[model samples]
Target: MTGRTPAPSDRTSRRRRAGVVVPHQPTRLQRLLARLVFLLIRAVALTLRRSLVDRTGCHDPLPPRAIYAVWHNRLALCLEAYRTYARPRSAARGLAALVSASRDGGFLAAVLECYGVRPVRGSSSRRGPQALLELTTWAERGYDLAITPDGPRGPRYVVQDGVISLAQVTGLPIVPASYRLSRFLRLRSWDGFIVPLPFARWEVILGKPLHVPRQVSETEREEFRRELQRRLLEITQD
Candidate 1:
């Protein structure tokens, strides 16, 4: 044999091993279900003033091209709130989210797509590098990027470095955001997933935008992460 390496028999297999395969396309039924869910969320959010809080910045009038950082536990309610508040602000600019690379994230991606939210599937602990790269590209393309600072098998409410890294790389301000519900069911899951009961009073809070230097020190990174965690907790705390 020559010194050159032999090519893989299947491109698909090679791609899978390299973690570069295309995501699965949802079926028609799946798409329909996703659409139904999206519509229901929008309807519910629109109907209840108490069920949603939308505290945005003056930056809303200007196109939204920043990074939105939220906690994992408040995901469900936050999704609806974003659709109501942030959607209109960023509709023209486009919005993309960093989802987990796990199978569960596949379903989540489909759901997001139904709401016109593009999913850049990856997580801080899984496929993180690729996800960060994708997010940077999306941000450079003027898409508002959203990330759950504590997500995808979280330590529950703790912020990871990925979000900070993303902001630094994309040169986008990190907007700390969260939601609080007067009545909701909290899942026993790792992140204590929260689901707001219909008609429940909700408060969506947005902290001032935070910026990270592209060449921050490790200490600075950790400090920023801690600040983000504290801000999310302050908004979501009962």
Candidate 2:
């Protein structure tokens, strides 16, 4: 006896059984709180950066187009630095970041909006496909893409395939950047979430652009990934 093809509802049920479900929606109050937290963090970061790291990177304008890749843990300070430095200097070239699609990520999207950073919601584990499509579309429309290669919950600084894949698809150079702080607190989180105290000394490190060729092989991809990981580690090393 032969089995019949499954109905659309049956297929949907099977997918749910495989562990996919709609995400929870954040309440307005929750969003407000998240925005407040984001503003507070941005304020602290800007203040610390002003007193600490010299605005060298910001002094020169950013290329009209480029991909910005930074570590997940360093995101707190990075957001502020990019806006105060790169964005305005680039004459508002505009930046689109890959954020997670989880409910927790809703807050992050809101936060990025407050800073004039566009958020494309997705991650390796969720909404990744849709987000990637959106990112590519935005890139075509002239927005510089920003990605936290190891993010939305992490093994703490491990670079993921998404960054490389995006570079290959978009033919954009991955500009690796990170910052080190003299007096900062590291959260006991997966990414050791770095938060610099106000007026702390800091160094903003920008590495050369990394290019991923369109015809890269599996081995070559891994090599580039390792190289990116090494550069990021070097920048963040205390």
Candidate 3:
């Protein structure tokens, strides 16, 4: 007998089973906390409905895929901004983002799913190669890849090397982006996590795309990384 075609969900499940990367499998307390956090985020997001300022010259016909690089602190808002700005360009295109494979990351993956985004579990220190390959596969399938270049524990706002490698391997331009809020709270977390209050006006900035050539040397890659960091910081407002 012949087997039936697998659903997308099934494929994702298989990837996890095959050790590509796995989402959080929390304990009871953690599960409850994740749910509660998701609720709070949902309430705030719905009430606020933040706005974006498209400076990246990527409107009307959105590019097929540009690796979205954003600061870790701005992860919350940028996810929403990207879904709002890029998803409508064509229903066919989707987004697959990198999330850490940690306990906290498990909570974050749940949150992203709540917002209709696919979360790939991995980080610089865990399953990094698997995540890169999976993200590349997603990009090939027309899904815009989103990554926090400074994430999974950070030196605070410094871009990591993985993103540069990703751009070089995938031949996708690195699009540095961020959102500024008129009113917000800052956490003592390493990335200086910003939590925007409800009804605050948002100024979302999409900086120019930095393309990394396929034949880039190690020195050239670091140069591109610094350039990416500069461009990202340039669009960010204090």
Clashes of each: 1, 0, 0
Full-model lDDT, candidate 1: 0.76
Better of 1 and 3 by lDDT: 3
Question: Which ten-residue region of model 2 has the weakest summed lDDT?
Answer: 50-59
Clash pairs, candidate 3, are none
Question: How well does each candidate superpose onto the true structure, as a TM-score?
Answer: 0.84, 0.83, 0.84
Decoy 1 TM-score against native: 0.84
lDDT of 3 by residue, 82-136 (tens): 7667667644377888999888988787777767777888999888988888888
Model 3 misplaced stretches (Cα beyond 4 Å):
1-32, 90-92
RMSD of each: 4.2, 5.4, 6.3
Least accurate 10 contiguous residues by lDDT in model 1: 51-60
Better of 2 and 3 by TM-score: 3
Candidate of highest lDDT: 3
Sort all candidates by lDDT, best to worst. Answer: 3, 2, 1
